[model samples]
Target: MTLLAGGTDLMVDLNFGRKRPERVVAIDRVPELSHLEGNGHVRMGAGVTYTRMLAEDVGSAALREAARTVGSPQIRNAGTLGGNIATSSPAGDTLPVLAALDAVVVLRSKQGERRVPFAQFMTGPKKNVRRADELVVGAEWDDAGPAQTFMKVGTRNAMVIAIAGLALVVDRPRRRVGVGLGSCGPTILRAPQAEAFAAAIFEAHGWDRHLTPSDAELKEFGRLVATAARPIDDVRGTAAYRRHVLAVMGERALARVWSIT
Candidate 1:
């Protein structure tokens, strides 16, 4: 079976001695695995690169924006969505976007093929998974509501890792909240409380009339996002600071979605 996806993690791991697999099958140049096709449920080849993600007009704006934040034009050109999941990085820029969209991954082996949800695919930090003989071919996207955006806090921009990152997908239809933290904890996560809270808050404020949410409500929603984070104090930042960033990011995300000052 082929182990393909941007090769960012696999190549690095092999080089750094973090991991070494005896038998390696590359799918980087496979035409069938490099195309992004399908509708209603967007089916992407596991080999589709980040550059493809940034350029796609079909997917949500949030995903495109998040793709823009990935390593660089070079990295985006090389990285694949399947690679992001294979790396099992909680801070993968596209990961939270996938989670917020409730994406499904297609895994195949000599035995057969199975579809797994993004949430279930990510078992933990730097984990979840494929056996020695299994292949992760591609992933499919679902619809996320309107006015979605992605934000991340790092030492700098361009190619820096996320100290804490968030993707807010807002809509009256499929309201979802995906928060991805880098160097914060084990895995990327969906903020259920924050999602539910934001939905209720938005419902209370009314999505149809465009009523403004009060500062208190906004701050509370921010707190919920913060509460959902599991950041840690590392060389780059502190847990408290990470929490603060989550709140500020969440607030700004909400504001940006609404185009409020």
Candidate 2:
């Protein structure tokens, strides 16, 4: 049975004659998968749309920012996070935020329910770990707090696919840092080394809620973020250009999140 939520991706392909399905199971109306719950780890139902995220406090600064980078108002209203996760596109704006937030993908089937880490859920571009009978119920992750940011570099300012993207999350109280890269990798990736470096910087700064790293530190962090990516040349951008832009974005995101000029 084909699972359908919001039908944004499915409809796009169907309308363009890119896909033809004999049958589909509409999951968007499933009440269990249509609500948001939990506080520490916000659990968003698969059917939740970008418009709803922006309209309400979806709980993560990075996620809300990423949601804003999605398609226009109409698309945002119709496109669901479950669709984006299930579609597994490299340019899916919300995936990077999920990665940085260390999200858990919740899957359900006739057999039972299972949870997969966001990193392990997506195998490659348009590929994921969900079984044929499994349905994506939702995603869960801890709040990214106020210091998180999501930035996408695209050919156009709006309604454009990202050439490169970055998501950064800083938890001052926990002195933790998270980084996710998008559009420049086969699947969204976290820069462990870069995260570690940033965490150390946060500690050195006394976990200052407003601490901003020095220029040299930011540069090194950006370099590490670039090094973590395994990008390729594509029509949207060249591998070299992606690396360069990601480096700059990493620095800029850090500066923005930390309130640095």
Candidate 3:
């Protein structure tokens, strides 16, 4: 039983930790866990590189867009979505996208396999997981929704830690707003209040399907999103700034979803 992904978080921890495990194994080379298969319901290999994700014709707006934002081409070439989930960093590029897409994680062990929703798999920052013996063979998602958009605020445009990042998936019939906050709390946050807030706004305005927000509605929505954040001021930015950025980004996400549709 060992942790295997891109080895990013594990390698880092092992270097810093005094107690090193005596036994170790790497399954990154497992061919079965490295291919993207299944179309009706998407199944992503645990070792599927971000480079593969970006290059694939697999047209998931959420995954496609996220693949582009992941690290440098080199990092993307090395990092895996399974690694992102395994790391459980709130700032993980793929996480907000997965959470918004309402994706599922597949965990496997010698015993068998179990699937957990993305949100449930992510209990807290740098956490949420499977047993020591379990391997994250892949992830699965269903496309019963609208196109999506991903947003994040880092010091620079790319290759930066997200102060706050959000993903919005709008399937008019199942209209939903999924928000993920990084570096704001121990775990990525889901803004239930903000979701309802946006839903009300959408409901009141009628299902235009092309939902547009007035400045008032935008501000109100932002405030609700702001409340969902549990940001702390650090070297990167301030809590107030995180709240404000998340709000602005969220509005942009909303606009993008509409435009895409």
Which candidate achieves the best TM-score against the true structure?
2
Count clashing residue pairs per candidate.
Answer: 0, 0, 2
Candidate 3 residue runs with Cα over 4 Å from true position: 15-19, 38-40, 144-146, 201-208
Best by lDDT: 2
Candidate 1 vs. true structure, TM-score = 0.90
The segments of candidate 2 whose C-alpha lies over 4 angstroms from its true place after superposition are 259-261
Local error of candidate 3 at residue 150 (angstroms):
0.8
lDDT of each: 0.75, 0.88, 0.75
Q: Give RMSD to native, each candidate.
A: 2.5, 1.8, 2.4
Per-residue lDDT tens digits for candidate 3, residues 77-174, read 77887888777888887887777667899999889999999888877767786777778887887763545767778889888888878777664556
lDDT of 2 by residue, 1-261 (tens): 577777878988989998888888787677777788757769999988998888557888888888998989988988898999999999999999999988999999899999999989999999999998888889998765678899999999999999999999987756688899999889998999999998887777666656756899889989999999999998999999999999999998888887521
TM-score (C-alpha, index-matched) for candidate 3: 0.88
Model 1 misses residue 121 by how many Å?
1.6
TM-score of each: 0.90, 0.95, 0.88
Pairs that clash in candidate 3: 125-186, 125-187
